[model samples]
Target: MEKKVQQYYKLKQKQKEIEKELAGLREEIIAYCSSQDSSDAELGSYKVKLVVQNRKEYDDAKLYETLSDPEVWRLLSRADPAKVASLVKLNVISDERIHHTYTLKTVTLLQVDKK
Candidate 1:
């Protein structure tokens, strides 16, 4: 048991070191790609590319108000767990009402800490 725990800790430390080195290398690659005025570069068997992504944020209240159909909003929206839990605690909703609606699964996670 102790051997497994020690191995887990060692692997986590190695992962952190690898991630740090990758971030530094990624910066250099991006700089090179930008300086060349090209999105892609080829190095022997390996190729690297710089990608740009755009994400959109919407005003929920205005969006819903502007929508012609209420069903469209229902189809797009999902329940928030924190809000539901708060409502249950406040006696606004019953646990039995929502209990059978969702499946419950158990997940196991391993975490190692240095002291």
Candidate 2:
């Protein structure tokens, strides 16, 4: 058990070092691609392609103020888990009702830390 723990710790340390080096290389590659103004490049047997992704975010309060229909806001909004949990704790919502409404899951993880 001790030997396995030691091996796992050593592997995790090596992984962190490798990830740090990879992060630096990734930045350099991105810089090179931007400087050349090309999305695709080839080096020896490796081919690199730059991918651009865009995301849209809206302000909920502003959206609500702009919208005429309350139903539209209701359609866009979903139940918040934290608020539901608070209701359950306050006894406003019964445990049986919560159990029927949502599926509960528990996750277990093992973490090794250097002392």
Candidate 3:
């Protein structure tokens, strides 16, 4: 009986941990969705529309295939700054505002050009 009670408590604790992790993940998704790039406002509340102009799914292998090209970074560096700004304005890239210290490194590797 005591062993069964301990097992039951352990199961409950594990369930609570899973729930907490799931909630954290949901918050992360929300943060990513309503990120600074996606919507911006100061002080009071404001409405912003988010539209996914293009959507496609890539599995782990396909994702690796898309990301493993070394030439991509070189091409990005060679792209026009103005065009990169326009692309950012068009929401072509993820809109997470990185810190200034990591700015050059992060932006150069990815197609995220700050406007």
* Per-residue alpha-carbon lDDT of candidate 2 for residues 39-108, written as tens digits (9 for 90 to 100): 7777666777776643223344544454336664454463455554555578755556435445444422
TM-score of each: 0.49, 0.49, 0.30
Residue range 13-114, candidate 1, lDDT tens digits: 999999999777777777777789877667666766655643223344544454325564454354444554565688755666555444444332222223
Better candidate by TM-score, 1 or 3? 1
Best by lDDT: 2
lDDT of each: 0.58, 0.59, 0.44
- Check candidate 1 and list the clashing pairs: none
TM-score of 2: 0.49
Q: Provide the lowest-lDDT 10-residue window in model 2.
A: 106-115
Q: Which ten residues in a row have the lowest lDDT in candidate 3?
A: 101-110
Q: What is candidate 1's CA lDDT for residue 109?
A: 24
Off by over 4 Å in 2: 56-115
Better of 2 and 3 by lDDT: 2
TM-score of 1: 0.49
